[model samples]
Target: MKWRVESSNMKQLAAVLVCLLAACLADKPQPCTSPPLLTGAFTVSTQNEELWQYAQFIYDALGQKIRMKDLGTYDNQSFTHDVLLLFREGVMYEINDLNRTCKKLPLKADFHPLAIPKDAVLLGQVVIGSSSGPGQGLLVNTWTGDIGGTYMMTVTEFGCIPVTTVQHTNKFGWIMTSFFNNIIGITDPSKLNPPDFCPDAMTEDVTREPADFWSLFFNK
Candidate 1:
């Protein structure tokens, strides 16, 4: 009887230790850097029903470029495609693989589609970690324009890489939702290389006069 009681107490202590270890691991912060390759599915929900949206991304941090494929369904039809965007040496290029073309456009400072809009407000820090890993999270201000509701977004991270984002708005259903999975480091160097062909410059305003150009230059 004494031996059995001692063994039972030992088991309980072991279980307690395991729980503590897990709690500690869960609280650890993920890295702020992004993974090289991340593939994932997004979903849009309305009337309690959900539809799958597609997104696959490859990041070339060293080259400051990104390649992505985005697919979504509209009007009961589906569409799919890929696009490569390069930002190098104060220039931006939009590459079209199927047409074998590239478009050089003016580089708007700090312009990124996924970046938090300049008008949005920044909220306090947050933690969205789950069982799989820590999701050091960011809470920010947002809005549901169509429904005229209050919106909030939580950008979740995994070791510096943003792996998931959860958005919510009062009076608005699940309008947008996205998360990442199958993240892997990039191994192929070719994915970072720029296209060999030269791209044409974006069309300029035809109405601008020579004097206007001089004025712009002098102002800069």
Candidate 2:
């Protein structure tokens, strides 16, 4: 009985040690010097020189991860983007230099601040996953919803109209986790507006006025 108990305890100790190691290895991402997530009424900085002012709920203290509702804006015109995102889950913190919103939908991804135009956006984020499962691999259930998601927004101006692309995937590739994928796209060219919605609120017009606004906020 004594030997059996000792063996079980040893196994538990080993498991605990392994978990701690992984937790150390895989961390969460964050941003540095970001304006505390704004709510109600907030202003943000951006490099694009189009989007200038913005706001967030600014309601409660959040965790390493923040949802769209808390840090997203799904306007009748523009797609939603993050108020901010951590490079990972806990390590590098990304500054919201873009001050952008989502792409009207989710784009499966692993990290945040998707594409910082400049390396000077030195700040980064740490992305962490669950350490509870067997160490089969990383991003296994990414496609199957076994694990949650990491989101990002990519915008391309195809002309007067802008094409917004969103691709979301698990932290680990599908080979590691389940088979789950959430990659979607949306484009608002001042043409398509849902019936009964405000027209101006929905279009992404990056004209000189808005562009200038973004420049002042981000460069400053």
Give the per-residue lDDT digits (tens) of candidate 1, residues 140-176.
Answer: 2222222134444444443343434444433234545
What's each prediction's TM-score? 0.44, 0.19
Residue 197, model 1: lDDT of: 62
Worst 10 residues of 2 by lDDT: 156-165
**Top candidate by lDDT:** 1
Q: Which segments of candidate 2 are over 4 A away from where they belong?
A: 28-188, 191-220
Task: Flag regions of model 1 displaced more than 4 Å.
Answer: 1-53, 74-81, 88-92, 107-161, 168-175, 198-200, 203-220
Give, for candidate 1, the lowest lDDT window spanning 10 residues. Answer: 210-219
